[model samples]
Target: MRYKNLIFDADHTLINYTADERDALKRIFEEIGLKFSDKMLDRCCYLSEFTWTETGLYDVKNERIQREYHNLYKTHLDLLFTRIFTEFPCSFSPIRAGELLLKYLKDGTNSISHAEETIKKLKTEKGYNIYIATNGLIDIQVGRLKRFAPYLDGLFISEELKEIKPNPLFFKKILERLNCTVKECLMIGDSLLSDIAGADGVGMDSCWFNPKSKENQSGTKPRYEIKDLTDLLQIL
Candidate 1:
């Protein structure tokens, strides 16, 4: 095998984050005394993605402009509530709403197809060092990975590490921590922009798990592309 250390992405790579997040959003809205609808969910997702993208575009590493994630998360919740109130008939107390939503999100769980089997096969048969490299809230990603942590050698979350993906520093930090070279590690994930691009930036090989068959608009190419997690067996 060319790769010894396989750095797998958590969400959408080994776990179905979309399913968990949607379910959590619905449950959170209901618990907050608001009606949940697919449209509302879509809006919430859009706003959240937009906010994160815009924030990411800035030089977040700069000390003068660097902001705490808690503050950003609070702003996200506030924006979500304001949008919900404006477009839909909803009422809720703002007190502790962010924390309540975070609880629901953190507790939600969903595993991707063949995730456990693939990990076991790679570790046992291929003698590969499997580690999770994910970008998201520490508590939420950690909660989601609890069941799979026993199968992994290590787990790295962006919030705890303070280094978001698509940035070369994130990959560099992971390599430094593992004491591995870029040529020896493989990045497997679903996102073209973050997973593929980040790995490419650091001269590491990447495999894009396109379960949905989404077009690669970002022009970032992965060394391997597989439609299913099980397909990884053939590659490895």
Candidate 2:
């Protein structure tokens, strides 16, 4: 009732990312003549999960995750790619891999479950200035938004601005760009470290989209917490 702008996170909040990542990984392996393995998948899962607090790389956006989350599997694949003549006669190019990854991200068939109808309803019916504030690669996030949720308006991504949320500067940058007061904006996201803390720092209200039932451990409080995004209609 008091907010003028509605900000949302892209990955889990809007676009279902786990399903997307799995498909992308399989495509990358197929290109390299390798089948997706449970073991390799586990390593990637750990890196993405722990990279935030474990490595402090929460704001760093990525196109090819293997480049950043380097594990034994990627190293092995690189070696396999070198002997292309023997490893099935195809080539492996980093550029090509990057393109494939982006393709997987943009493909709606690969996206996680989304409340697309709810987002459309909220914006056209409720008149909220919807925006995406995600901590993922800008190109990918933008592409996903354009394809799936074009009805929304502004986007504040970490890659484009050179800052990640939960860092005070991240929220500050968005606030300055939008020229909106903190009291007039609401941050809704899955990550407490990034979205919740970042919004709280700027004296803005936040809604914790806890779809996974994760605990913050840091004890920060969000303005609201909801298990399902459909619940957003109640608050908005």
TM-score of 1: 0.84
Residue-wise lDDT of candidate 2 within 106-200, one digit each (tens)?
A: 66454334578778877888888888887666666777777545677788877677666666777899989999899999998888877788788
**Per-prediction count of colliding residue pairs?**
0, 1
lDDT of each: 0.79, 0.69
- Estimate TM-scores for all models: 0.84, 0.76
List where candidate 1 sits over 4 angstroms from the true fold: 37-73
- Candidate whose TM-score is highest: 1
lDDT measured at residue 201 in model 2 versus the true structure, 0 to 100: 84
In terms of lDDT, the best-performing candidate is 1
lDDT of 1 by residue, 1-236 (tens): 89989989987788876677677778877776777678878887776667555544333444432335435655666666566566766666443555666777777678898999899889988899999998777887788888777678999888777777777888999999999899999999988877898899999999999988988887788999999988989989
**Which ranges in model 2 have alpha carbons more than 4 Å from their true place?**
37-55, 58-99, 108-114
